[model samples]
Target chain A: MSWLIDPFADFVFMQRALLGCIAISLGATPVGVFLLLRRMSLTGDAMAHAILPGAAVGYLVAGLNLGAMTIGGVVAGLIVAVLTGAVARFTALREDASLAAFYLISLALGVLLVSLKGSNVDLMHVLFGTVLALDDAALTLLCAITTFTLVALAMVFRPLVLECADPRFLASVSRWSGPVHFLFLGLVVLNLVAGFQALGTLMAVGIMILPAAAARFWANSIGGMLAVAATVVAVSSVAGLLASFHAGLPSGPAIILAAGTLYLLSLAFGPSGSLAARYWPRAHLEA
Target chain B: MALRIRDLTLGYDRHPAVHHLDLDLAPGSLTAVVGPNGAGKSTLLKGLTGELAPLEGCIDRGVARLAYLPQLSEVDRSFPIAVGAFVAMGLWHRVGAFGRVGGQDAARVAEALAAVGLTGFDKRPISALSGGQVQRVMFARLLLQDADLILLDEPFTALDIKTAADLLAVVQRWHGQGRTVLAVLHDIEAVRRHFPETLLLAREKVAHGATDTVLTAENLFRARQMSEAFDDTANVCVRPATRGAA
Candidate 1:
């Protein structure tokens, strides 16, 4: 308990890191649950990589300026998301295939840009992130993004769920399907941008998707899944930060690894639909 | 008329899935759209609901609230939503994105569930339901929609007999309330028995009149032959300048 409690209490950086993680968990996990429900988990992963080039460009232009990097990341991500959707809709290529093509290009371009302008350490920071070193600007940005995400998600909650459940029906009744879908993609990109500050572009989606995938085993409804996912994310963040402080591990990967471990555990033992649950069946419902 | 269309040509990529259709739906008409598999029955419904834009003509729906039920396959059965919440989405037009589901609304959802014979199924997840139960849930949703015009596409394709009968009774109830209803159906016997008007289509309007007259063997055979003769690689339609002059 002392080991777990002392570092965050003593170190300001550790406290900031914890706060950042909590902010991210509050916002990103709900979006992750929707992505999981829409079967767009890989799309989330792709959009994460898609933001790399934008952040790299930002770094190239302003040298780690938070505002520059955030704006650049968001613009780049929106461009990629919109372009991928347009290509899928207009051309014969499927969405996944087009997304794969765009994300691969974006990843290569980001790596090349980062390596061309900065040292190896700088490149690593941009890719894997420096969660423990989050400053005032990054912390404020994280909190603000989380605040906006929560509000926007609430505003669009009903339509977003309807769009996911029955898109054609929503389209027939109201003209909200297209706008709601784009708004959701915007939220995904916004959360990824927020995650990128603390987790890096490469690992940002890990926090968003891993806990959501794990939550599926524990909960049977969307609301339940969201709750379980947010809880998992919060726990993983604390555990990862503590591990990073005690051992010599990188914080972002440490956090993501914690989430991964929980995911595997849930896969095997969660009561809702896990392997253990299947092996030791509960009694059937009276209905 | 509740709805009118003139020279409607709806399609994907301009290939004209439903070609050159002219139609008028009266304020309280209960009509069935029947044809062979490729006769554009679903496409016509899509055109009416504005899901597919017409290529060469227009649909004029004059101030009518519309409710459309697509095929069961269109609904994401695996979505993690409860039956009650799913059915309550029908009130979207009234409640909108941020509106609360008031106590009265909850009662309406309960009544809808009871109407569909799923009275205590409010808390059940949609993924746990059978195909027939899911159809019943969709019907309950339509009941809550309370639209002036209702369109159902293949509402009973794979449903069990009892579920189909129950849903058909719901349709009859809507008709009795003087709401206009149009359904795309493959079952000619059901259409003939329940629907007063029929439209036989084969990428074109082969006939539109009384169910007994339009569903004759000759018209159905013509619809089938027209559908079979459709040119997959055909160019964009070249209708004459004037309707009768063609």
Candidate 2:
């Protein structure tokens, strides 16, 4: 217990890091739930990598200011989402093909922009995050994004879930399917951008999606799945933060590693259709 | 309580699947649209429910709320949702875009499950259910919508006989309550016995009126020929008169 509490007392930066982790995870996990359910986890991945160009451009124009960079990231993310959707809907191109094409283009553009600006190190910090250097402003921005995302998610939870489940039915009942889809996708984009500091583009979606997928291993209902996911994300973020602080490792990658561990444990030991289920004496009966 | 359609034309892209068709859906009646494959039976219902845009006509009494159920095959039911949560989607349009579901939503969902004879199965995951059970789940969803205009497309194509009868019984109850139901069916006997009104289509309105008038030999043969022309495997709809008939 003393060792656990030591990090909190010895370093102000550690406390800030922990708080930042909480904020990023909170904003991301619910969005992750919808993403996994809608089979848009891949889209989340593409968008996360897709934000590189926008953030690079923002850094070139305005340095590492939080507000300016977030706007730039969101604009770029939305553009990728819209373009991918249009290619799929209007043309013969498949969704995966469009996503891949857009992802590579945006990534190359980001690389080109970063080269032009001569900030390769800064670009690394932006991509992988520099959570050890987190300050009060970064914490505040994280908190604000988490709160806004949570509030918006709470309001549109039902429709979003339904739309993911059966869009045709939504179309039959209401004329607002298009708006609902865009709103849900927009929230996802916002949360991913907000989470970039703590989890990085490569691992942010993993933190967002894997824990929720793990939660589904235990819960049978939507409400239960959501609650379980929130708990998992909260626990993993704290665990990851503590581990990083003790070992003097990067917090973002450490947090994602912790999340990945939880996913494995859920897969191994969860009751219904898990790895443990296979080894039970009466497992054959379940089948 | 009449759903009137005037010069309703429907299609995908710029091409027309249904053209210049007029229909009056009677209140408190079960109307079945039966025809050959590609005969626009499903397309017609899609136009009415506003899922597919109409190229030409207008729907009278357009303000009425609508509910729709597609064929069991049409939906990807492998999604991880519970029987109760599935039914609760009916209230989605009612909840408003930014609203949270509360006690009222729960009550309506419970009521829908009970109405469809799935009272105790509310918490069961949808993936655990049989095909027939999924169809009932959809009916439960329709009950929660409480929309005056209900449209179903080939809802009984894959269910067992007992399950199909049970679901049709639910539809009969809805009809008795003075709600409008438009169901697409391939089984003519079920249509004749369950629905009083019938619309026969072969890329157009081949026959539209009471079941007895439209279920004649000539119309059935014409519908069959069209079915063969379009897709040979499409079920040929023929209504069997009661065993006590001439």
Candidate 3:
């Protein structure tokens, strides 16, 4: 208890890191749940990778200026997203294949751009993130991104669900499908940019997708999955931060690894569809 | 409100699936579209619902609100949503994306579920339902839509007899409420039994009139023949001159 209490209480940096993680978890996890529901978990990962080249370009231009990097990342991400969608729509290639092509190219471009100007240490920081060294500016950006995500998500909640569940029905009823989908993509890119500040471009999607995949085992409804995913992310953030502090490990991987462990646990023991529940079945309900 | 479709051509990639179609659906008319597998019964509905833009013509629906039920395959049933919440989506026109679901809305949802024989099953996840139950849930959603015009594509194709009959009753109730209903169906007998008007199509309209007249053997055969005669590599159509054309 003291190990958990003392670090957060005494160290201001630790407090900021924790707050940053919690804020990201609140915003990104719900988006992650929808991503999972839409079967776009890998799309989140692809988009995360897609953010790198823009971020790297920002690094090349302005070094460590937060605004420069954030804008660059967002622009690059939206470009990839739009291009991938267009390729899928206009060509014979499907969305997943197009996405894979774009993300791979984006990743290679990012690595090349980073190496062109910065040393290996700066490159490592960009790839793996510097969670422990979050300044007031970085923290404020994360909070702002989270606030926008929550409000936008609230606004698009019903139509978003309908778009995922029954797109044709939604199209028939309202003309909001295209706008809602693009808005959701914008949210995904924005959250990834925020997570990139805390977890790096490479591991940014880890905090999103892992907890969402884990929540699928524990909950049976969209709202329930969202609640469970947010909880998992929050808990994993605390555990990972504490572990990284104690073991002198890199913070981003530690947080992601914590989320990975929770996913495995949920897969094995969660009440809804876990391996344990499957093997040791409950009695049938009396209808 | 009446719907007038003039020279509608709908398809994928500019290759028309439904071609040179002209139709007039009377207000409160209960109509069934019957044809072979590739006869574009679904395409016409897609055109009407605005899911597919017409390649050649227009549908004038006159500001009527529409509720469309695509084939079950179009819906992602694996999505994690409660039966009640899924059904409540019908109130989208009223509640919209941000509007709250009030107490009366909840009661309306319950009534819809009850109408579809899904009483007290509100909390069940849609993933847990069988094919018949899923169809019922879709019907419940339609009940809540409360639209002036309804379109159903293959609504009873895979449903069990009981489920089909129950759903048919719901469709009839919509007719009783003086709403225009158009359904794409395979069971000619069911269409004859329930729907008063029939439009026999095979990528092109074969006949459009009262069910008994339009569903005759000659019309049905012509529709099948026209469907079978479709050319996969055919170029864009050159329509023959109409009677009044110069």
Candidate 4:
């Protein structure tokens, strides 16, 4: 208990970091559940990479400014999303192909920009993240983004579900299909950009997708999945932060590893498609 | 007429699936679009529902309210939605995405569910439902839609006869209410039994009139003939470019 309380008590940075990661978990995991259910996990990964070039450009222009990097990441993500949509619609390439192409290009450009201007330490910080040293602006941004995302999700909840459940029916009934789709995509980009500031682009995706995939094993409804995913993410965040502090591990990778652990645990034990059900089929059948 | 399509050329990738078509679906009538596989039956319904855009000409949707139940295969059945919640989606027009589904709305859903023989299935997850149960659920949703024009694509395909009959009763109820129902079906016997009118299409309008007249041996033979011609290499219908821009 002292070990748990002391780290947070001794350091304001730890408190801020916890708040930031928790905020992200609360907002991003729900969005991640929607992505998983929509089969857009790879899209989330694409957007995460797509944010890199923009953040790198921001880092080059403003030198570690939170506002600049966030704006850059968001713009970059939106551009990739739009380009993917256009290419998929107007060309022979499927959406996944177009998205993969754009993400690869975006990632390459991001690495090039970082290598060209920034030092190795700066690159390390950008790639791996510094959750322990999140500034006032970063914490505030994370909280603001969480609030915005949760509110937007609530507003678009019904149409988003309809759009996912039966797109053609939604299209025939109302003209909100395009708006609902683009709005959901916008939420994905915004959440990924918000997450990258604390978790790094690579590890932020881990916090989202792994928790979401794990949650699906336990629940089938959106509300239940969202709750389960948020819980998994919050626990993973705590475990990662503790590991980073106590064992001298890097925070982002540690957090992702924690999430991966939860995913594995879920795959083995969670009710829906768990190993328990697979091996003990008769009990499940009786139930 | 509930829907009027004039010289409509519906297709994908610039190749027409239903070409040079003129159709007027009468108000308050039951019409079946029966065609062999790939005879543009689905394309024609999609055109009416505004899912597919016509490459040439246009469709005048005379009815303001329209409802559609797409093919079962097209719906992501594994989506995390419950029967009651899904059935409530029919009120989207009135509720506008954000509006609450109040007590009256709940009653409507319950009534709709009862009409389609899906009572007490409110909390059941759609994925847990069998194909027949899912079809019943879709029909209940269609009932709740209260649309002036209802389009159903393979509404009874793969459904057991009892389930089909139960769902068909709902369609009949809608037709009895003087609402126009356009259905795409493969069952000629069901069409002749229930649907008073039929449009037999084979890449073109083979016949369109009374069900018995349209489903005649001669008309079906013509439709089959047209479809077989499609198998040959010389399947393209050519014109002298009369409609090109000046």
DockQ winner among the candidates?
3
The sequence of per-residue lDDT tens digits that candidate 2 reaches over residues B1-246 is 468777767876555567566777767668889887888887887777666888776777543677778654335576778887778777766765656678989988887787767888887888898878888888888888887878888888888878787788888888888888888899988887878999888766778889989988899889777532333344533323222221
Error of 4 at A143 (Å): 0.9
Model 3 C-alpha lDDT per residue in residues A4-115, reported as the tens digit of each score:
8999999999999999999988999999999988999999989999999999999999998788999999999999988888898799999899989999999899989998
lDDT of 2 by residue, A44-101 (tens): 8888888878877887889877777778788888888888878888999988799889
Largest lDDT belongs to which candidate?
3
- Cα interface RMSD of each candidate: 1.1, 2.4, 1.1, 1.4
Which residue segments of model 1 deviate by more than 4 Å?
B232-246
TM-score versus the correct structure, for each prediction: 0.95, 0.89, 0.95, 0.94
Q: Write the per-residue lDDT of candidate 4 for residues B123-241, one digit (tens) a residue.
A: 98899899899888888888878899998899998889899998898889888999999999998899999999998999888888899988999999888876433333445666433
lDDT of 4 by residue, A39-145 (tens): 88888988888989999999999998889989999999999988888898799999999999999999999999999897999887777778888988888889998
Error of 2 at B213 (Å): 1.5
Clashing pairs in 2: none
Give the Å shift of residue A57 in candidate 4.
1.1
Which lDDT values do the candidates have, in the order given?
Answer: 0.89, 0.78, 0.90, 0.86
Supply the DockQ value of model 3.
0.80
- What clash pairs does model 3 have? none
Winner by lDDT between candidate 4 and candidate 1: 1
**Candidate 4: regions farther than 4 A off:** A282-287, B228-246
Question: Could you list the chain B TM-scores for each candidate?
Answer: 0.94, 0.84, 0.94, 0.91
**lDDT, residue A122, candidate 1:** 84
Clashing pairs in 1: none
